[model samples]
Target: MAKAIGRGRGPTIIDVARVAGVSKMTVSRVINNEAGVRDGTRKAVLAAIRTLNYEPNIAARTLVTAGEARVGVVYSNPSAAFMSDFLIGVFEEAAAKGVRLTLVKGEDGLAPPEAELRRMAQGVDGVVLAPPLGELPAIRQVLSDAHLPTAVVAVGQPTGEGISVRIDDWQASHDMARHLLSLGHRRIGFIAGNPDQSSSALRLEGCRAAVDATPGAELIIAQGAFSYTSGLRAAEWLLDEACPPTAIFASNDDMAAAAVSVAHRRHLDVPRDLTVVGFDDTTVATTLWPPLTTIRQPVRQMAATALELLMGAIRNGAPAAGDHLLSHALVERQSTAPPNRARAPAPALS
Candidate 1:
């Protein structure tokens, strides 16, 4: 029988290392199921873990014993701010876990060629598909056929194809729209995300639902590719109308920043002449003048979680079933406020 600690705290990694008569690094390697320690040493660590009843942290609990596991991360997302944050999380977690990562970038909004995917499959134990790429069924099929465990990030919902880590896009957008409505903005223009991704539709649906539920509220929709340039066009389209919206809600920070630019170009004072809000509170959200009111999507955390899931699946010989929905928050910044009904439109930039 294992001896229990007198203190309330449970046995830790250090305790496991001590009981096994090995270094903490050894214990970590054993916990991660990495190749290195001799059979005897591995057995000793396992025995200590069992005897002490030590529960590894969530990241350490996934046992990938075949070898030093290699994970491939595939991304084709257009948002630089979002990708920068997400890659930081993934790299940090992978480094801590002592796993190798291979990055594959899709070209022209398409998944990596079949030959490239096959090569990637041979080199890596599992894969993490970042958004836009995650939405591609062909990519999923290729990975599936390769028998590689997979985890997808930023998908709107689980497709029963692999482990999914994302937030509830519909609910998040709905809440943002509700925030605008509460602030007394009834005519709101919504700039949508890339149509190729599942989140775009769900976000639009969320905004529409909120507008439909409220009396005297109207929603005007414009398409965007989740790019700053696309946002520019969308914002221009909405603002050029005979009856322009008092407020604009963009599906992401890039679009929201563009809306702010447009507002500035027309010499309209934000919140006094127009109120702009956005989702995915990325780096651009705060960097902009009059920082945007937006949804904090936890992009970095989601990427980390997805990688963890991919590791777990690689370890267990099967992907974990179901979706993991992380929480999102509406961060109120300087951009949103009650509409000023009496304001007049200023002259457009020459």
Candidate 2:
């Protein structure tokens, strides 16, 4: 008698073959999307697979005899709501690939990183990192030391500075600036993100390039710590400047929301009186009174592709290297416009 594979333990190819009255080779072909199997046989095999809740082992050899394979995702956040989308993106892809996402959240609080990494590394076949937080050299080194296939989904730049999956942040910001400039705005305010992150530095560089490209346009730059409070302070400084910018661009949605708040308190109408824009199309973009026009980060698609890349690496029977850059789109919401009704340029003091 064949030993039963317990529920939630994952069904093997042999289990599918036995239940469907077919050979293991046929099951393999069907799972890989190969076209040789008979349609009727394929349906039977699929039905049996569904009956047993069968999920093919995406890690290949690691599935059969060894312990359960884990895919570690190192994220940085103080709370879950901060990364609700990230967690959803990661786990949904993991489930489709029949791999588990072993999450490790690190920042100021939570568990000791080294100890946590060690614990999370247990039975892990690959690693996925979500950053500005995860793009650290030390973090990649830890994954390298484990010799696991790894992918980094960056929050900032798409330099692939390290092994990562990112969109071109510099180009994205540059495009954002150009959009505002096309609307006939001359003086533009730019708020940067965390200083330590490569992404933040890259975005600032993009803004500078845009300013350099637009003749007669002045760049009003302020550094923010990538938080709502930091965003408010930075926007306040820019707004306080004499002959303040007509348009404001924030590096992320959180800061952008803060900027809108400042504009509101000053009784400035968005788009008509002052144009505001933000990066990363988070829920906050739509939730704001005037929905933000921002860059759409392909987070969920990146997450899915990361899983596919990791699985491919695992099947190759070696550790993974390098990075992947996904495409990004501009989601134009209601937050941005030309400073058309510009009134006496609004006293910078206000």
Clashes of each: 0, 2
TM-score of each model, in listed order: 0.80, 0.76
Global lDDT of model 1: 0.83
Per-residue C-alpha lDDT of model 2 across residues 1-350, encoded as one tens digit per residue? 33477766677766675576544444555677655456777788788788877778764333433323467777774323336667778888777767766778777423337867866654465777776556566666665554455676765644443346778989988888889889988899999887887878888888789888989998999999778888899888888887788989998888888899988888788877878898878777888879999888876777677767766555433235566778888888888877765362354342
Model 2: per-residue Cα lDDT at residue 294: 88
Model 1, range 1-350, lDDT digits (tens) per residue? 34456597888765675566544445667787776467777888899998988889864444333236678899877788988888988999898777899999886457888788878865666788888888788888777655566788889867887789999999999999999999998999999998878899999999999999999999999999898899999999898877889999999999999999999989898878999999998999999889999999999999999888776654443334568999999999999889887874454555
lDDT of 2 at 47: 88
Off by over 4 Å in 2: 1-62, 65-68, 78-82, 108-112, 155-163, 344-350
In terms of lDDT, the poorest run of 10 residues in model 2 is 59-68
Best-matching candidate per TM-score:
1
Question: Per-residue lDDT for 123 in model 2?
Answer: 49
What does candidate 2 score in Cα RMSD to the true structure?
10.0
Q: For model 1, where is the 10-residue window of minimal lDDT?
A: 58-67
Q: Name model 1 segments beyond 4 Å from true.
A: 1-67, 344-350
Candidate 1 versus the native: TM-score?
Answer: 0.80
